[model samples]
Target: MRELVFALDYDPGWNTLADTLADFPDARVRSLSLHATADSLWRVDHATGSPDALSAIEDAFLTADYYADCLATEPCGADSETEVLDETDDTLVLYTYWQRTPVCTSIPHLALEHLGDGLLFETQHEQRRHTWRIIHPEDADIHGFFDALHAELSADVNVEIIRLTGLSATNTATFSAEEGTLTREQREALTAAVHHGFYNTPREIDLGELAEELGLPRSTLTYRVRRAEAEIIKQYMNHDPVSPSDPTS
Candidate 1:
């Protein structure tokens, strides 16, 4: 199995929340999940920013061009089935269901659906980056897939392959490389934290120092490290290899 990760840049004028984020460059959208059915696309968008920025973010969706087919929209800060949709300055969540459009009209989603079982669409930001996990079979034509994808994208949009794994003969791991792994930023933050004695008894480096080293704001670094640690702990505790009775555990 092979996984391909890509950072997709969408047109500024497009309706993607990525475009809206451009309106507030400092704001970051941590995409929780996105799933597309035959008729509609469901997405959970999590955003964070200053009070003024969050105010503008709330208005972004209200005026978003992407929601033209939005059959129903539960605005952020409202009590609903979704838990994280809170009315806070630093955090906002939106639950959206969008009508499916043509391939030419929708750059990535339409192309992803065409891959069928050969490729799995993982996650995407409004205008920043999108990741996909592709499992290659012996008979699969990987090159052809890329060709078809490029044909749909405009010249301005750039696609970059961030990483590739599980191809060497000596490597016999059953799992796909990079499958369900921490994101690049998360990985870097966690790695840096460990090196700076973040997990040590005395804690050599604080959040401020770590954020400075990573060139990210203190808040951003805190979020990244926490999310990364949560994922690592989740994977370790849930993994099937460890037995409850094992002495190592």
Candidate 2:
């Protein structure tokens, strides 16, 4: 399999959803699941933010203009609809079903047309940027798909290719600290770092601040985090699946 990572930046006036996201910079949206066929598409999206932001996003989802702007296609037909599957003060889950696939120019449609089936997609939306990660068969026509994507996008949408890499079947292995893949201290440090937004863009907290919060020396915290990260990456690269228990037992 091969993986492709890319991002799309939408100009403020060109996309209602993007503009709304830009208005609430702290809000984020992620695709929880997606299923698309030649004639239809359905997806579940999760959004997290302040209540006001969530409200605004929900409003956008209810509007036909948002779908039109998002898919870069004509307005949704009568058969299309969106439902709020769940909602809370700071989070919203939406399920959308679209039946007008023939007029849609969404990424999924384009991918299905050019890349064939069995492609896995992960997406994240923040501010005006939408990022996509696609894992597809090794024999897929990646360049052709890229060209089709560019051709389908509007002039106001800017696209960037972040990565294109081959993946071994085992490279999909994941790490679980609870399975003894990481030492206790390392897990704690890593958890603290993430909880404090150390990995966020423009980081919400610095290493020194994180160390102070954890009551640890800066170097100690740094070392633990680094070691934890190294272990996770090693597991991913080495395809060493962390089993919950000894299979031989």
Candidate 3:
């Protein structure tokens, strides 16, 4: 199967939110999740990048022109049921439900329905991050999918393909980090790593701070991170063993 991740810098004509997020100098919408079912579209936004960013979020949602009214609003933790931790200063967890119909139909949404049950979609709002995982079948055509999307969305958006890769079953296991198999500790460790920008170049949080935030000893946290990293790499590499002497591997 193959997955394609892309970002769309939408045209102003199609932007449902009236306020420009760029206006806020310090605020940024991070790790946004958009779930559009048959009846409603909900956006769960995680605020980071600045202490006052949460206020920016409040302003955006309050001034958005898409919905007639707010369906619901609530505090949501990042990828778990637990509340946002105080140590993580930038994590402003929030979810807002929009009762009105979507102003514009998303190309990914149509593509998933067209492919039936084989494809999965994960998307974001302000960042407009989109990931599509397609289980390849005899009839599937990657080229055709891109062509169709171009035809449908080109008028209102510039679609840029960021990355595409093929993953066999073994490799995809690590990519997904199967929650069913990972212990709670492992999940939290991995999730925190992502949230803290550990994967980015020039690293945001050091090992010590990450350990402090998770309230674990540095050695224990290192062990958990390595185990989770190993689990993922093992799947990607088809269970090939890392060199015993090189922990960085």
Candidate 4:
């Protein structure tokens, strides 16, 4: 198998969903699951941010016009619907079902057309960037897929190739850890803290400042950072290996 990882950096003016993400730099959305056919797409997404950010994201996602505009196609107004599966101060889970005609150009549809079936997709969206990781057969036409994706996107959307390599057991284990070991919120908190020098002796930023920057409550940010630190320390001390029973492996 081979793994293809790429990112689309959007000019917010071209995509409303990306525009909303641009407005809230601290907000992030990751796909829990995605299933797509020629005529339909079903997706479950997990989002992390402050209450206001989550509310804005929910509004952008549920509004059919947003999808239509993003896809640069005719409206799928009645053909799409979204449900809030769960929500909290810092997290929101959403399920969306969208029906599309062949004319609608979406990433999944493009993948189906060029890469064929039996491909695994992992995706995340944050700060006007959408990243996609696809695991597919060795023989998949990756070049064709990339070309098609470039052709489909508007001139303002920049496509970046992050990785394209033969998948190894080590890569599989790494992907498993990334998707399973840390919750999205935990990862986000830990990343922000580390980036802003929360661990430095002379800290560059305090916990409260980091919390404010992330648009998360102080207590909530503290909990997530603490939990993430504990998890990292445990993993280091125990030298835990990716389990043989792991589904991804």
- Model 3, range 1-249, lDDT digits (tens) per residue? 545555544444344331344444454554355555544445555666555555555555555544312211222111211223222456566666643334334443455444344555554444322223334332344445555565555333444444444554344322343446667788788789879976543246655677899789977876676566545533433432233474533
Candidate 1 versus the native: TM-score? 0.49
TM values, all candidates: 0.49, 0.66, 0.44, 0.66
- Model 4: lowest-lDDT 10 consecutive positions: 233-242
- Backbone clashes in candidate 1 total 2
Candidate number that wins on lDDT, 2 or 4:
2
Ranking by lDDT: 2, 4, 1, 3
Q: Which of the two candidates, 2 or 3, achieves a greater lDDT against the reference?
A: 2
Candidates 1 and 2: which is better by TM-score? 2
**Candidate 1 C-alpha error for residue 93, in Å:** 1.2
Candidate 2 residue 93 Cα shift, in angstroms, is 0.5
- Between candidates 1 and 3, the one scoring higher on TM-score is 1
Which one wins on lDDT?
A: 2
Predicted structure 3, TM vs. truth: 0.44
Backbone clashes in each candidate structure, one number apiece?
2, 0, 0, 0
Local distance difference test scores for all models: 0.52, 0.72, 0.48, 0.71
Over the stretch 1-249, how does candidate 4's per-residue lDDT look in tens digits? 667777776765777677898889899999999888878888899999999999999998887473522255345343677899999999999998878755666888778887779878899888777889887765565656666665676655655555555555666423223347889899888788779976543346766777899898887886676566445533432332345586754
For residues 184-249, write the lDDT of model 1, one tens digit per residue: 889888788879875543346666776888789987886676566445534432333333695643
